[model samples]
Target: MSEPQTASAVEEERHASWPELFFDLVVVAGAGLLAHLIEDGDGWSSLFLFAVAFGAFWMIWTCFTAYGNVRGDDARLPTFLVGMAVLSVMVAAVPGIHEGHAQAFAIAYVVGRVAAARPWHGATVVVDLPVIQAFTGVLPWIVSFWVDGDAKYLWWAAGLTIDLLQLLRAREDKLLEGAQERLDHVAERRREQLAAHEERARRDGAEAPAMSARARRRQRRIDRLEKAGRVGRQIPTSIVALRTDNVHLAERFGLFTLILLGEGLIQMLNAASGAEWDRMLVVAWAGAFALIVALWNLAVRHGSAGVALLAHGAIPVRVQWVAHLVTSLALVAVAAVLGVVLAHPARTLEEHEVLVLAGALALYLLVSATVHAVLARRGGGVEDGRRAAWLAGAGVIAPAVVIVARESLSAAAVVCVLAAAALLVSVVDRRARLRLTGARDGRAVPASTP
Candidate 1:
């Protein structure tokens, strides 16, 4: 159940607002901290903890995101802002999370999530599955505080496993009931409009469309029943409902991605500022920029297009949002890689650094490809080999580079390879677009102008 909608809440903006921007900044700050966490801890253990920790935080964010999707920016706007602020505090404590400050961090984490889970609108919104699932999952993190050492993380493992299993157990029909609330909301609006129009007609003595004799009798009976307070029913709905503004959801998700991309550039420049004026450093910096640009194109440009596909009814919102989540995690991993490379441009990365890049790109490529495939299958757009090859190639690039490149040459070598791959993807995408447009050779508008 949702609360009554306010006029201000109903009129949404075309893009993420200032509050949304602030929320994303906090989320990205936490993601950046996770990279540092991985760097500071024991190789595999810290990485595992990072994954678990990230999942917990991301799950909470996603909970709020879904809630906002249903309620829009009006009602829950303040709640979302306050929740992210608390969540930022929770994420800030991630470094000492398993150690001295574990209790403080856990409390912040729980409070933040609980804050985000509360109702956003004046309407009586029944706390739904997204929040319920997140709170249930947070129990393990909370309980972990009572225990000592590695066993705490084990509890985390158990909690998330249960949370995920429960999510899996959710009814597909209800889970996919995607647009019922939105549909009902729309129906309510239409009803209001009809009533208003009818009132205007009566006041102005303007004739409305003529009703059949049976229709007139039905209307009279309905009016009488309403006066007698006996009319009661809910709106009828079907299974294929999608009530969300797909563009708005996509736009919000894209803004969040942009937040990370901005951070990557800021961090990279900050790291490069003090480095030696050597040839390798300059080349590495360039490579880093190219990599970021390439990633931006992959994650944001096409990502918005996928949202457009959903908005246009070419694909399911569920699949697109899932793609956004996986792709977002992968983008965070890319940010982690950028942090590593930028921090030590001249030095060769360790095996773990290489693996991080590999894993992130693997997921990014796979998810990007999958979303593109989904759009392509729906005939939303034509598939190009240039984009396809790069999408398929990134996953395969990292491990091979890490293994074969020598220590002194590895860092620059990896950067160059990735830069080339990204550049080639653009070249391929450009040429294919030109051919499609029947342009023999004048400059074409670049794909994903950002």
Candidate 2:
């Protein structure tokens, strides 16, 4: 049987608001600018620059989105729009990222993070301060302005790492607080129960009831250990996990994924329209669309399950955070590849294009595999393990297919190969899901589960 839902869980069913949607539209513009960064560049330098720049941009989104997730309806519209406007300045700076615009980008990012870190108009910061402490990550970015050459990217990477680590640390801190609260409540309940038992025994004109054998034994052990100074005695405690209402946050991330996919599709379509219509181009377009659909299937399935697990406190929030980060970054990189693929469907794939596509596919699947592994470890069943293994296998193989086929295969054929691999993975994932559901229902395995 399922656990009962809390009132907070029921209340968290609310969807994203219109102001949030408006905020996302501005993000879409930023994504487009980031995509163009690597459209014509070669080698890992372009990829590295794109990753760092996009990391900063993603952090900006994280700051505002984190604020919105906590504040909910109280999150101001003007504040979001002002952040959006700052993001626009950041987006405008993207085209000249390596030129004179890097400092502008860093400035906008810092300004945006500061603005979104807490409430405006003299609101009490005590309630929301811990939830939005992302501004501290900007110190490295501030130092990057004076640094020249590739060393600046090192600072950018450090800043993003700090932000990511801070998020994880904050999550740990909240968990500790929740666990302490739970421990205190348990101790209080135990005290009340003991008092009630003593009163009942007194009313009966007899001695207080004896403790259970197991409790007595455990207490004796604790006493012995304390006398020896080997262990500190503590109240009854079990594993306590911090559970919060993550439905809104999950939905927010899901929407952002959808927007990334939409932007990718738009890039593909725009590229197709610009190129001369040919059979190979049509084939490439179809393959690219299929790849996107497969990714959507994977992302949606994992995202929905993740949101459920989050609601139940079955997994760490940091894992989900990292999953979304990897998913978004991979999709952005794929968008850049899609633009290149559609722009020259008949031409041989470039070295950088092959590498970028392969890397993105590999990174995405590996993260998916990690997510599934985490789910399985949290009692999501053996089927989850099977899915993780399959995803990991595909992550390894997909890149090999890209790397090997790039030499002899046309761009369209290479794309088809990737789409085929993704489609096969999707098919396996669907079968595994069906079989798992059947098992849970105490029914026969479905005929389709080969």
Candidate 3:
């Protein structure tokens, strides 16, 4: 069972403060705008726009996650300011995503990352290492635009990858420090409890009154010390912080997926208005949209739910978040590609696009299922892998149904099948819950008659 929240605890934690919420909103809007800019372009320009947009989104999220993990407090106002700056750059880059604003976008992104790191740097004692490391790593990339013509992107990718890896490492270190602190507190409490028990025993058996009084005093001291140690142990660890951070990351991914869906919808609306609403075109658009929704469910709902369930002790919290973040990005990349394909004039789905989407979906489901299985095994239980198998099987069957029965099965019919499958999963979840409740009741003692 979870601990109850008190008013003081609520005040101290301040997880839902205004500034933090505002910062999240800014990220959502910025991501949507970036997706919109990419969806409005074509061919190589479209790809470039996507790269620039993704770069911006990735930089912002990385900084947010890194700082949130390191600081352990929202520090909302400053975070909001940084978010606004990112949004400003995204707005400026919207006009010429491919050519005119590339340099501006890159500079803004690099500066934003640097700025976000500053607060965390100030808070830590070993600040110079990360600061020097960040600047030294980013400087070459910032300079590469002048020196390298063909491999400029390589410089950016390399620098960004280093920063990301460093962020993960820092988070891992923080979690280790936290676990050590908790262990120390627990040990201290155990010592005090033993001392108290011994002193109480001595007091009870003591023949001399003076000796008994002394023993009582010592017992009181031990009691106070033990209480203090227990309180210290109650302080939440960095692993809990990482779990909350990953939830935020998952929410961000969900928002981006919605934005991609919106982009697809806008493209379809434009196509429909242009009198291109033939049967094949309509079927293609519907399939693309359904694919986007499935991808979103795979990444945000199922994937995140699995992570939240598994992130207990089987893996380090920081590693779990990093893995989830990578998976989320891969899903977003796949969605971006789908958005591009949907926006184009082509009616038939390309083999490469289908393969990419299918592969990403499969990988997402497989990773999540594996994590769940590991967590269950660690807890001396087992997860029915059948649910994961069902989802993956649906992913394969849904596309095939759309392709083979495009003319016979309307989009609404396909949607109904998807809904029915979702309902079936819901039924399974309900049955599992009932069984769990029954097990809990079996362990409960009957109440005495009133």
Candidate 4:
């Protein structure tokens, strides 16, 4: 007789809750502040500040998110909220980071981190370098009030680099440890689990049993995921181990991306708040808004954006991380640029500003193309092929966008160029779908359904 899998199934399949959603919204506010900094501070300096601040926010968010993904029970929910509250306070102080709120920011960051460190079952956080990195990242902010000028940012940058290098290198070591070694680790874990179960059975005056069917099923899944190679796609190796329910991880990622897109749209609205409603501004506004919306469809709404991460056992976990990171940062930058462009529709952009916008759009295209390429290589059905080609065409046109925004033309011209590019990509996208419908089997589905 099959045992009814009720409570465990309910807990495991639980989606993110209202509290977590609120926490993410708070962090989105922080992202907006970071982008706004670029408008205030001198160009490169502001950009540097955004990088350092964004890096810190991203690290904290990523840690908490991972914890959320694999956390054992709902009992820790309140404790997690305490951590998020402290994080909210820290985010509020970010605007004053270069000024007087150093002490407040430092203390809040430490408290939030301590709360985030609450133990997870079986998983040890004792030597986690990423946590150490997050703490180290706060050090510069602590003494930021004393250190004057760009040298301060240098310290933050140096500390961040050290922490990142360690994480990357450690992940690389695990990847190179090879499939046999990974399988061995899985077996060892299984043994420990079964041995404990046997002890319990004996204590109850019964015969000790072998690994249960559920445990066996989990191990088999891990084996399949671990043995999943990067041969079909260009993803060489996995830096993270993703097994069991991948929707858990993918859902978290999708939430974060939605936040980034929201940040862009929010900035755009803030930029156009009370400005005059002339014909040119209206056209430029619509175009910039469409650009943002089109981007969402390209990756989030449509199947093209699907990393097919969990489905394609052939790809590595790190690819998903990298892809998500690229998507977040690119969308953030696009939002910031669009806001600036919308602000001065008829006026020629400062030479530096024009250059920045051009570079940002190009970066967006490059990252988009990369995401699509991975999906296509993974055999992500018709949408993948169609979207990949569309991305290629948009990339080709991106440069021409900058050229059109010559010194003689208004900065608004850049908006026009990007809009045109967006439309062109849409056309390609439609063509891709129509051109490759039901192209038969042996193809990997592009995660079309939720």
The root-mean-square deviation over C-alpha atoms between each candidate and the true structure, in angstroms, is: 11.6, 14.5, 15.0, 12.6
Better of 2 and 3 by lDDT: 2
- Candidate 1, 242: how far from true, in Å? 8.7
Question: What TM-score, over all chains together, does every model reach?
Answer: 0.71, 0.77, 0.57, 0.69
In model 2, the Cα lDDT at residue 392 comes to: 86
Off by over 4 Å in 2: 1-10, 120-131, 170-244, 301-314
Report every candidate's CA lDDT.
0.61, 0.71, 0.50, 0.58
Which candidate ranks first by lDDT, i.e. highest?
Answer: 2
* lDDT (10s digit) by residue, model 4, range 270-344: 777856678768877887877777666655655222331123322444455545554566666667767777776
Model 1 / residue 395 / CA error / Å: 2.3
Candidate 2 structure lDDT: 0.71
For residues 319-414, write the lDDT of model 2, one tens digit per residue: 566567767888888877887789899988887888888788888888777767887898988777887788888888978977977888778877
Lowest lDDT 10-residue stretch of candidate 2:
120-129
What is the model-wide C-alpha lDDT for candidate 4? Answer: 0.58
By lDDT, the better pick of 1 and 2 is 2
Which residue ranges in model 1 land beyond 4 Å of their true spot?
1-13, 120-135, 161-169, 175-243, 305-315, 373-389, 406-408, 439-450
lDDT of 3 at 160: 60
Q: Per-residue CA lDDT of candidate 3, range 338-372, in tens?
A: 54443443444344444444444445555655665
